[model samples]
Target: MTEVKKQKPGNSVLGLFKEIFNWYPSSYPAAERKLLFKLDLSILIFACLCFFVKFLDQTNISNAYVSGLKEDFALNGNELNYFNVCYYVAYVIFQVPGMLLMSRPQLSRWLLPTLEVLWGICTFAQSRVTNVHQLYALRFLVGMLEAPVFAGTHFILGSWYSGPELFKRAGTWFICNPLGSMISGYLQSAAYTNLSGVGGMEGWRWLFIIDGIFTLPVALLGFIVFPGVPDSPKPFYFTSDDIALARARLARAKIRKPGPLNLDVFKRSLARWHIWIFVLCYICMIIGGYPTSYMNLWLKAEGFSVVQINQLPTVTYAINILASWLGTTLATIYPSWTIYTGATGGMVFSGICMIVWNIPKALKFVAWYVFGVSGCLSPILYSTVNTVVKGDSEERALIMGSMMTFGYSFNIWVPLLLFPTAGPNGAPRWRIGWPVAMTFHILLWAGFITSLLLHRRE
Candidate 1:
């Protein structure tokens, strides 16, 4: 898995263009070159910033629990895990339409930003929750608000960018996620140690309030900068030939097996070679990756004081950012093989961290740092959808849309539903992490191998 590999390709640009013609039906407009590039750059910047803030608000809960909420609510026996579950349930329910609508890339300019504001408010509302029920309601709504985020962003990026370009854009988005996580982790740590003085609010509540305030402005900015396909917008640079190409692209999109919530698409997605492989792979990567969300509580349970607990999550996330950058950079420079090596090493490192649960508490932290290497893979994979599947713009959009929706469903469910449970015994029971973490790696490596083989066969 660590080995770098190469893809078979025609040597010349013309051969590459011809290969694209065999599978790509989406035509381009002969727009003014300068305007086309300008609009795309503007949108990409806007979208990346929006994603960055959105993540900051979303991961606030993890911080809240570690800082104060768990003690105030006296949460016990997987309550935090339940918190993960609640949001995920709502997240799973709403992802499909968000993705499918991208079939008309035109819809995303409005759709993406609108959802941002709605979810931003939900994150703000979470600050006011006085009990578990209220937390549940607010978190659930936040999930619904956030449903379109990853899936929506995936479509938007793909609509404007080509296959090779997908990794960087997807990496751009994933980088936002960890950056969000890092920010949230640090904020959570800080709230616990210092910021509990805003109108008698607990540190957790203040965390939500602060996060909301941060997100609202960015959401507004999204409208001004969000990018989509060249034909989808007004005042775009397009020649008559380019317009014809764009039309052909849309026509091709229609035939790639798209429809409204149909069983066929669902079944096909489930049977997709990528699906089970990813599930097994991610289940472990995520399981190993669990520390990102749970690190605060773990720090406390492991004998760190509140101030120390603060440093734990923030530091671990810093390591993850480094890992994410390394992984993405590798893929960017060596598009053919960096990912598989990163994926295996990352998952296995995460497992080893957990497996050696008793060796020294410090090693778990190191393990998390290593796990960060693969932390960005899922989102990067979403960006790579175009490479794996061939369709006209419309059909390709549908496939990406559907896949992203389902992909988020996995994101929503796995953390909350599949995460192991323990007791209200007031101690972190991660001792059982050995088999659990090992199981995760076995499945994930299987996924990497499977995806590699499938990509090779294709």
Candidate 2:
């Protein structure tokens, strides 16, 4: 038998490689590892909690769609699409501005948790929507509130983790969506089975209620222990030395990707083809990604029972949770390559799966597998930016803002192309939409190829 090599402390590159390329697990003691896991766990739980609320919000609207939401609101195809479109508008309008404002170490302390509460309040209010207009108004407000959550989380990681650590921890944050997917799925399922008719509430109504109700307290808890940049004042736990270590560590990471400093900085950064390159890259991602958002609806239309539709997102999420970490492990070494490849490749596989969606019921499980495995690809986009950029607060902020603004800004219109008017169903028949969407994989793959060329020079 072959023996494994010993690892040294502080070998970020080697450790990352071992995680991705080797078979043996780390030899850290279970006791110490458990304790360390708890440390990361405590921090991760809050981060995951914050993510859970918003990610649930992300797909719950679609979950509502097949859960008798249309019947409740009497929504036309265009009106329902408008409800979906409004959130992206809020998301686009606020993303860069929020990142800019939150770049401050201190300002984020207030804004991050506060939005959670505010968004939670809005989520609770969504339970009251009686019209497509009301759904649009509420969803737009929810997206406006959530704009800060993702970018804010990435900026916060810059203060805390090193390059090697970013992907795994970013995995921790992104994994929550898969978990949230599972949660939303089961909750949607349970509501359909047990609660949709109880108290005269529909499953969609319960989705908003349960999500909002869970979010409020978690947001409050976030205010208590969530860490900020080393410069900020905390409640009582961190010593001055701890703060100094935090700054020193961050300073080291920043040296690797130092930000542009002059007026030319703005010109230089914007002039790069990468801005448009990644924008197109993510546009393809969202094209494939938009299908997952409608999974509950799609499954319902395919004649799966309501219970199955409600439960499907969670199973998909569980696969995603595992895949998200695995994707991180792959990216820690290849950072951009792993995700860019995965996103485009996942679209292809997922597309092929859709072509076979009419396969036997036993084979339908393959669809979710294809769906779940790609969960980690999206987070790597932000992780790639975090891995590469270096600078003082403003330049760093601009880098993140520019990447994400372009990345997400296009999503607002993407849904229109795939799910445009399809008679009374508001969703296209799977046979029609799936093929059109699959063809988009070719475009996304082209984006990935170009991105790889650009990244090789960097």
Candidate 3:
């Protein structure tokens, strides 16, 4: 691997000021800036588009339920939770295997886009489900296919960008999570109003059809643009010199190239604290952030009109997008310690207000809105994992996949108990849910402290 000379830290007051506005230092070479631009256009933009549609397909089920699927299918029990359970189970099963496949240089380009295409077909098939069982099967397929996207994309990102650059890019990519959900809300609203009963299909069904259509073009584009990893065979868009510069940049940052994914890799990963600690952190953050998904169900219980239900919760996503941007920017300027503490702290506050459940209507609204900040934690956490495991590519991929696998494996049962739809504790004020969420948020703080100590000792 080629190694570039390390640039001096921009520690002056002026340098600090510049960082707030620019992602790269003013002292960076013009060629490096051009390289960043190319990477952003090819890798970052495509990653965002792919993730946006993945979430759009994934979240549309909730939107569809609230729109008309619940009534049309007469879903009276905890069927929504069952659907989520099905998806989570498949996702947990496939998560690690998918990441391992993506780790192969020969498979990286083909696997991601092919998975996207298959999932798109499944997403489209959901529109034709006449019964809940068919919908469950389709959801399982979609989840299995999408299992690789988030973790796999992060692995690809870690291979190309260094620590300082990864957060901004990862955070930017993560914004699409909320963005896709936000757009699904508006899309459902529009379809319900304008396309209801068109071709004798419910507006909710149309949502799936439109979302499935969005996935295909993006997946096709990925085959053309995705550059795999820096050490892998280069795409036509990048010249040899460009690939060398990318390697030099990562080398200077002390990021090692790919090591064989053998028994030794698994042994080394398990022996380290990185995998265990980071997995716990991810689980806490995910579980703590669960109640936000129920905001629409709460609105429905409050007797809001269908259109209002669809549009109102989008504000939460908007807030989430802003919070994600602010978190990334702050991490860029100050210590990332701020991101860990600040995001979990916000979720804890929101969860407290929710658990009380008797607060004013406006206060409840504020609680739901503030919960948006929790969405920022995922990118920051994943980026930290990438940095911590930088010396071993296979280990990094394994840890990331394991984090999602264990995290969602918990979700398979956790949500059924905590956020059940049939119990007295269900919906609007999920009595058990909010308190449980708050406790996990506190646990995330512990994880943060432990990670800090581990990093220092290393």
Model 2 alpha-carbon drift over 4 Å, by segment: 1-43, 197-200, 255-265, 333-343, 355-365, 424-436, 439-456
In order, the Cα lDDT scores of the candidates are: 0.60, 0.67, 0.85
Point out the higher-scoring one by TM-score: 2 or 3: 3
Error of 3 at 286 (Å): 1.6
* TM-score for each of the candidates: 0.79, 0.83, 0.95
lDDT of 1 by residue, 1-458 (tens): 21222223367767544443232223433352433355446666667777787778667776677677888998766777677778877876776666666555457567777877887788878888878989888878888777777666766665555443455456655677778877777777677557677678887787787787877777777666664444556423344565455445435442132234455555666655655554455445556445445566667767787666766666656655655555544454455345655566666766665655576756777765565666566665554455454344444444554554454455654544444445532234455554555565566556656666776676
Q: Where does model 3 exceed 4 Å of error?
A: 1-17
> Model 2, range 18-112, lDDT digits (tens) per residue?
56643223554444334335335545677789998788877777677777887777655566567767887888788878977676656766777
Better of 1 and 2 by lDDT: 2
Clashes per candidate (backbone, < 3 Å): 10, 5, 0
lDDT of 3 by residue, 166-203 (tens): 87788889999999999999999999999999999999
